[model samples]
Target: MAANKAKRPLPSAQPMRHNPNPQQILRPQYGLRISPAGSQPQRSRLHARETAQLMPVKAHVYRTIAELNGGFEKVIQDLQTLRQISFFRNDRVTAMHDLICRVRAQANRDFTMTLHGRELANAGHFDGLCIEWEKQIEDRSDT
Candidate 1:
């Protein structure tokens, strides 16, 4: 029994089959390198304080009719672009309508000021543009 046992090979003694070229071999040549901590630049407190102290600026207020009319042209272009994008269409349209109403109010105020003897350059042009924008808003609302 001792002689037979000695001739028998152990199960764990089988040779391992290795590929000549492994597909997922770890190549140490392409490994990442760790940089020294002293190589990084330091941030200054002055820059941080400067950024923190900055105040939020408000939107430009249109004082004259011509300026408001020019702004209206830009708003029309923006509204056209917004309409092309279908996502959140109703909300954007409502916001644009509100903006148009605010512009019309400003135009009315300018007209009132003109009645009080204040001269406004390009008042006729501005009035025409306001009328055109009102018609556009009406057309859009009808749909």
Candidate 2:
């Protein structure tokens, strides 16, 4: 014969405390504290400055010289447009110009490293064009 076991009673659940000011709840996951009603939260000047700067659009590496040339043309047009806009800062414009120069340099470097003999010789014209484009971008950024 098996002996019977006695069960213990479950403990009662405690009620959650209600918060009077719901807006002041701490949210650790978001890394932002909700300010109390009527008072504004302080923001850093760096954050405001960054928000004003124009972010560059994503660009892909072009495999062909034609594509690279087209990309450069598009960037130049964009820089020109940015200059005309009253809101864009000059430093931001210079940063964009520097980005374009870097892209051109990378393309040229890749072409030189990947090709040799006749292929390299054939791209001599393109090398000269790249130099001219770099000069143009620098001149535009300076003004």
Candidate 3:
């Protein structure tokens, strides 16, 4: 039979005060602790089918992207990457490839939108000029 005992009386219990400035606490307590239980909240017990896929985007990478695009493009870019990775549910490397594709897709879409918009503006100007030219021809024929 296995036996277990409290190691050291579990320390004297102290009444927890409402920490006014939680930031002042030496070790900030969180709603969830990041321990060996894995960095995520315990969900329905992991069956063989459910695998842990913890992908944390790093701060430096965030900073780098913010610098590149003045922060305007980071969130959507990251979300697109997340969606791409989600496609390869069981394969990590393939998911990473999907991440690259998402980024490339974002870049391609950005450029395509810019070109499409410029083309539309130019088309509008050309269309207006064509109308103006037709009116000028009618006026000249009347003269």
Candidate 4:
């Protein structure tokens, strides 16, 4: 009876699991290449093609931001001029209020555009524009 119960072979040991390296997916021509040493995260990893692609984007973003900021400045100056005019005359309150409303609307639009620009690549330097706009409107009671 003992001999009939035949010995069973032991199970083989499990194999070790393999760890796979992360796969790098490159864009058609706009992705940055990783540096071998990885010393600087921002300055070192930029590829030549990606840098060229970013130049035009950076220029356009800066130009747009500058123009919008200039427009805001002009509108604020105009409002200031209007305030000075109203100081000498009480009859222009209604007109001044209407002009203020218009200027406020334009400023709102500029703020929205600045936010949209932030979504674009390399256009994150919009804080200056936002701060300038806010500073101009800070003293005004109409805003």
What TM-scores do the predictions have? Answer: 0.29, 0.35, 0.35, 0.27
TM-score of 2: 0.35
Q: Lowest lDDT 10-mer window, candidate 4?
A: 1-10
User: How good is model 4 by TM-score?
Assistant: 0.27
Query: Where is model 4 more than 4 Å wrong at Cα?
Result: 1-58, 87-143
* Cα lDDT tens digits for candidate 4, 22-132: 453322333444555755323334455345333223344445555655665555656556666745554465476567668767876885576555445344334444676
The candidate scoring highest on lDDT is: 2
Cα lDDT tens digits, model 1, 17-125, are: 7874553342222322334666644335654443344332212222344455656666766676677777857676868867886877787787667543322334444
Q: Please list the C-alpha lDDT of all candidates, in the order they appear.
A: 0.54, 0.58, 0.51, 0.52
List where candidate 2 sits over 4 angstroms from the true fold: 1-63, 117-143
Candidate 1 Cα outliers beyond 4 Å, as residue runs: 1-64, 111-116, 119-143
- Which regions of candidate 3 fall more than 4 Å away from where they truly are? 1-90
* Residue range 1-143, candidate 2, lDDT tens digits: 25434333223223357765654544332234457878766445644443344232222222345465666766776787787778989788978978887888887777546554334444554565578799999999999
Better of 1 and 2 by lDDT: 2
RMSD, candidate 2, Å: 30.8
Instruction: Give per-residue lDDT, candidate 4, residue 120.
Output: 56
Candidate 4, residue 101: lDDT:
68
Give the better candidate number (1 or 3) by lDDT: 1
- State how far residue 46 of model 4 sits from its true place (Å): 18
Per-residue lDDT, model 3, residue 136, is 100
* Minimal lDDT window, size 10, model 1: 1-10
